[model samples]
Target: MQDRIEITVTDGVADVRLVRSDKMNALDAAMFKAIEEAGEQLRNDPSVRVAVLSGEGKAFCAGLDMANFAAMAEGGKSSEHKGGAKAVPKTLAERTHGIANQPQYAGWMWRELPMPVIAAVHGVALGGGLQVCLGADIRYAAPGTRLSVMEIKWGLVPDMAGTQLMRHLLRDDVVRELSYSGRIFTAEEALTMGLVTAVVEDPYEHAMTLARQIAGRNPDAIRANKRMFNAANYLSAEDGLMMESVEQDAIIGTPNQIEAVMAELEKRPAHFKD
Candidate 1:
């Protein structure tokens, strides 16, 4: 996985980078597997308070590799192989990884992580790349970075959990227009459309600084806040209120919570445990 993706944890922040800059970090079979594996690794690690994702070199990601498209055009399966043999291709409707398939999980896995994930997007994020960015809890993009729901250009839909993620972030009409047109939009426009959290001159640096600030807070409360927000996205108003109460109830009297209050009273940074 390190060949395609690299992860380094510092002060509870996981810095994840896509290293396939030679190909603009395009999603090939190996890249797909690497991304999923990276997410799984971070998900299982109790020490990771937050994660910042970025791509090395020019572009964040250029989406699906052109080779895969060529393979599909020639009637070859674009699926990955397992072990020493080619794995049988599964239908899109099949749920191979919980609620998502293999390819979709590459993007959706970030959302499954217990801690928040921030994406620092630069250059271009199209099709699958854009879907991956959507999976992050927060996204910061460099000014003028290009983005799109570009699967339509290749005669496909945004199947990598893009529709599910986008609907929550954008209006129905905006989603339809972007999905149908496959037109490139700049980060400034994405900020107006609510696709990106902010457009800045240096996204990675900004993301890391925010990650450090979040890491200094009470870990349990930060995690509970993320869980509550994620559930609120799909829960009923009553259920959402109950969830908030439940999460707050669990954290109110905890050691870390007390530490947070004491830290503020004492004018010192809280030291939270993993």
Candidate 2:
């Protein structure tokens, strides 16, 4: 990975860091590319049972770089890639990765990954940065961290998987309030409003600690749980319950399941299937 982003995988956990501290880890073309690459790499790596994403700077990310905004104001041609080199499908509804195109895939891909992804948020997570965090299965935020759906301030809508993720996390009115007002909120407020998984003094540390715990679990079972939970969001409660039963049945008495039970009974760590 480029210096703009750091990707490290060890002990079945991948830690992906955005390293543009000098720029507050702002989203530029380079950062977008790096994030996309990192997500793809983790997706393809079967050994990675969990992943943590965070920024190495005073902030997580400060949305779009000023230079890009300045160029747009000057009526420069839009540099946004139209799904990269991938050929467009005949109908938008038929695209494979749901509503995501190539640029959006950078954020959406994290959500689609079978294993859990955690976002360690600190300082500020605004616009595109916040959207990226939303893609994660869980968000760990620093106590005083600021978050926002701030695209309205830039005269643009969040185009990086924000809408879809917000829909899953916030009530309709709550989503509208955040998106329409472009207001920034503290981590405490985020926790109260269900925007973050937890508020901590050190988000990255908390996230990694959680990742390690997850890494010690039965990998196959954990992934199956994630899949069922993801499906639950779009399915009726009854249907979701049925799906859960089906998933549980698939894992019961399986090697990983038996290992998990044996580990618990023996007071030892699980030796799970990758």
Candidate 3:
């Protein structure tokens, strides 16, 4: 229903796209709202077993709007909130939404969703755009797609859930190098660096195909697997293994799991319930 963001769901897959192309899908205030709402929609859509995030036009996003940066430089608040007489946007350190604030939530929400979310990145996924892609479970990018952690160039750090996500995805040295330099890198290098799942000539097509494959699987098992995997990332090895056992215990012998086995035995696809 949002204008800046568009969603089209078909056959259990939701394609969520950023539609502002004129400025290469720059992040204006409206975009922030659109992204948040889009994520929320996919999260709640029971029929959506998988989601693909992509941008329309020539680029993914060019990061923050220049005017926003200029205003921040001039001592204006990035968000409009009030505390007594003074208003302040929530800082990055404060995880307003369980490891991210509202702005960062736009990216982080996708990671927390039950189903898989794939980013189909094209030209220029810089700063926040890169952060957005980091939120996805997987990233598919065009070979020449340009990506960077560009906040440093603007005298800002990457405060949009990027730091947390990168900690899991990149090596300590690689993270430090990219964050310090703010240099743009190609999608090919990103794949090698583990920033992308794969490189393709047409990233969107590849993403859709991947999404379809996931959507055809057992939804309940997929959600359980994602939860277990995410839990493993934050817990100790022993505790993570314990948690996986707990998750499996809860799902094993459930109707959907039974359906999954039956479908496999029947040489047909599963029809899992959400």
Per-prediction tally of clashes: 0, 0, 0
Q: Give the winner by lDDT: 1 or 2.
A: 1
From the highest TM-score down, the ranking of the candidates is 1, 3, 2
lDDT (Cα, tens digit) per residue for candidate 2, span 154-190: 8878777788888889898999999999999998999
Worst 10 residues of 1 by lDDT: 81-90
Q: Which candidate would rank higher by TM-score, 1 or 2?
A: 1
Q: Candidate 1: lDDT over CA atoms?
A: 0.90
TM-score of 1: 0.96
Candidate number with greatest lDDT: 1
Supply candidate 3's per-residue lDDT for 209.
Answer: 96
Off by over 4 Å in 2: 76-98
Clashing pairs in 2: none
By TM-score, is 2 or 3 better? 3
TM-score per prediction, in order, is 0.96, 0.90, 0.92
Candidate 2 Cα RMSD (Å): 3.4
| Better structure of 1 and 3 per TM-score | 1
How well is each residue in 110-188 modelled by candidate 1, as lDDT tens digits?
Answer: 8888999999999999999999989999999999999999999988899999999999999999999999999999999
Error of 2 at 169 (Å): 1.1
Q: Rate the local accuracy (lDDT) of all candidates.
A: 0.90, 0.83, 0.84
